[model samples]
Target chain A: MTEIKTETDPSGLVYVIGTEEEGMSWIGKESTPVEEPYAIEIRLIEHFAEGIEDPNPLYWSDEYAQQTRWASRIAPWGVIVLCKEHKVWRPEWMEDSGGQDTFFCSTPLPGNKLLATDYEVECYVPLKPGDNVFINEKIIDIKPKTFSLGEGHHITVENYFRNQNGDLCIKDSRTVFRYR
Target chain B: MQLPEIKDTYYEDVEVGDEIPEISIGPLSHTQFLFIASSHHDWYPGHHDVEYAREQGLPDIFMNATWQHALFQRVLCAWAGPNAIPRRIKYRMGKPIVRFDIVKARGVVTGKRIEKDECLVDLDIWLDKQDVDKVTKGSATVVLPSKG
Candidate 1:
């Protein structure tokens, strides 16, 4: 087994550097389920809606939402992506350590720069407040190619977000270009 | 903020070539970018720090993929009304949207079908910057209620 090398940037984002062979080896690998630190809240949903200037009453007024098929103030479908927990405050134990490890950032790929090129999402059900959300991600594809930025690979990761009852809420696939 | 009175778009009322009402987002400034970044919990420096973005070869701090996705949803839902449900969305980023770039979301109905007793409409959607550059392009599937 080759030793895996990693680098952390000033923002605490981790990058993996390895040979093409090592990169190919990452396909089909799945990350453990990561649950959001807290249950979905109405305030968080409103905050996201406000940021986008979306005034859909379904995402705002509980009274209005109660009259709809959803029966409650449900979040916008796009909020599924925001439900993932990214550590902003370092934990006491890791106060001096780099950022928390995420599957995409820790993939064994040779890249100093990363850009999201494509995004696809399918929603099965609406996420509501008090629902506990969790995600499980898998590396589905890796294609090495030369691009305008430089020589690199396009890695596609598929993420599954489910609610507390294990009902899948969203299936998202993101393609990111990792270049030099 | 006052919510707009929107008319719901029923599947029976849509035609194959009907265009959704276009909505413009910005000439985005740092304030908007910061709000979006913090709301999404994406603390990527390239999205907020101009110096870091320039160092990383970006023209300037720009909007992230998730923000663009939300913009698409906002346009779709705004046109289709609260009853419509977004089934799927697939988009590809074309150009980086930096500060002072106004993005407009537009869509045209391409097809419609009934699957599992649900009325589904397919549309081609995109985000254009400054009415010239197509900053992002994609397709989406939405479920709209039937007048029947």
Candidate 2:
């Protein structure tokens, strides 16, 4: 396979084009919402803690989690964001208008907290090692907005997390961008 | 808890195509979710709201792509250990990850080279089910401990 190089910014920042925004515009414009599901494993928890500079005992301490309300080691929100395999290809129907340099540009400028950049998490039950879970995702809504950088758009993608037993865990809304 | 102990090694010690140790994670509960949620302070009931998710045309609430991407990087974190600082990591959101999902994340040393003090290790990271191909795969560059 050919190596795809990341783009570099003038300020020496690098952009990893993990998610090729191909058919995203279609989902943003003409397509109906889409959904997908995945299985989770113990490794995910370890990754979660590594992301946010947190290595607290509770995360790995089974006894600690059992004693606490959490009842088990949980992952960090940053880990969730980072866990996504960004290089996954966009749907065949989706076309790429362009891409973003995530390193230098914070496309969704950190404001409005949840509203500006929507986030959601649900704990159906505490997860422990040796158990399997599932994740279901949907491209629910898309909205276009024009900012100082000309015409741009935002995507409202939703996700549902559950265990093999079919219990609900979490639902999330992610915003993707297309800016000039 | 402390990160798993990994021995230090130069890039020369790492051979291409070597499989880094796989890591296990999760089985989170409400309080665990709250701890993560409280830090970022970014939560939408739709993520946790079953009724809302169904209303929005989803089966149930799932994890965010960003979080999943971060979780996947732990494979690299374990391999690179303390000497390595993650320079780049990227993954795409294919499916939603519900609570209790057993996420199997791993890494392979795809490329390695030395640059003065920084011994670079290029790895291909993956997150998958116990018996599946791969859900997410991406490349990562880590600055490993130097031989010098």
Candidate 3:
């Protein structure tokens, strides 16, 4: 009997498995919409506070929140962050043949690092208990890049968080990865 | 009910190149990671479960992105007044955040602009700890009301 050894071939790497055009087509592939309510009885905000070890009064105490500038109890930022992850659509097709995700890189970033040249988060309203949040997530932008991580499509997933009344509460956008 | 006093940074008060006061947190713990995973309903075992973390090529459960973002928000509010409304927070995760790493949230005011009545503070932020190369880095924007 002979023993055979296996090694990963790093040569001739397929940086972009799909054409730029095909990747562009993925920019608006699908949208995920979900509704969530922040319930007071559950002390949802308190859980977040505990998780982060932050005891901001605005997150749990109505009396303190009423005295704050907003003058009302508001959800912790963590709650909203979890909502973003909750509604994000990570399709199965993005996985490579190796079963490794094409989106996450072995190295997160390369070189001197890019200046956070841009960032925008808009909150039209603060989340409160009994208020329902409507989240509509979509891939809004896609671009080709030969930057630090590697040659791949820079995909931006944007989420619009609206209140039950349809008012925008938060606009969060994160750029994820997809390699060829 | 008396609210915590808010001493806002007005448009005239900040200038480009000013470093926002830095806030330090951590010595990342497994318990914290598990707490966050549970809170977010992110049952991803690698983040908190030790065995799962080892299988994922990590020494142990580490700080996940969600909790890191939550920490960023805490750092942001450290200097921002009650009136400061966070508009954006963009971070590029650099490396695995392991246990007992004391990460520091350091930010600097990069640009300030006036759009109508709003004063927007543009900042370059980075999170790193002793012996740990920067694990997360990005920029943030906030809308602060100007003194009338």
Q: Per-residue lDDT of B1-148 in model 2, one digit per residue for the tens?
A: 4534434455667899988887666654444444454333324453555565465444556555555555654556556543345555555544445555656778888887766656777777767754444666566676666655
What is the fnat score of candidate 3? 0.43
Docking class of 2: incorrect
Query: What interface Cα RMSD is found for model 1?
Result: 2.0
Cα RMSD, each candidate = 2.2, 18.2, 8.9
B-chain TM-score, candidate 3: 0.90
By TM-score rank, best first, the candidates go 1, 3, 2
lDDT of 3 by residue, B1-148 (tens): 6556546667678889988877776777767776776678655455667875675456776676667677777676667765567777777777667778788878889999988667889888888887775678888887876776
lDDT per residue (tens digit) for residues B101-130 in model 1:
988999999999999999999999999998
Clash pairs (backbone) in predicted model 1? B26-B102
Question: Docking quality tier of candidate 1?
Answer: medium
What order do candidates take by lDDT, descending? 1, 3, 2
- For residues A67-100, write the lDDT of model 1, one tens digit per residue: 6677888777667656655677756876554324
For residue B125, model 1's alpha carbon misses the true position, in angstroms, by 0.2
Off by over 4 Å in 1: A91-100, B1-6
Over 4 Å off, model 2: A1-180, B1-6, B28-31, B115-117, B130-133
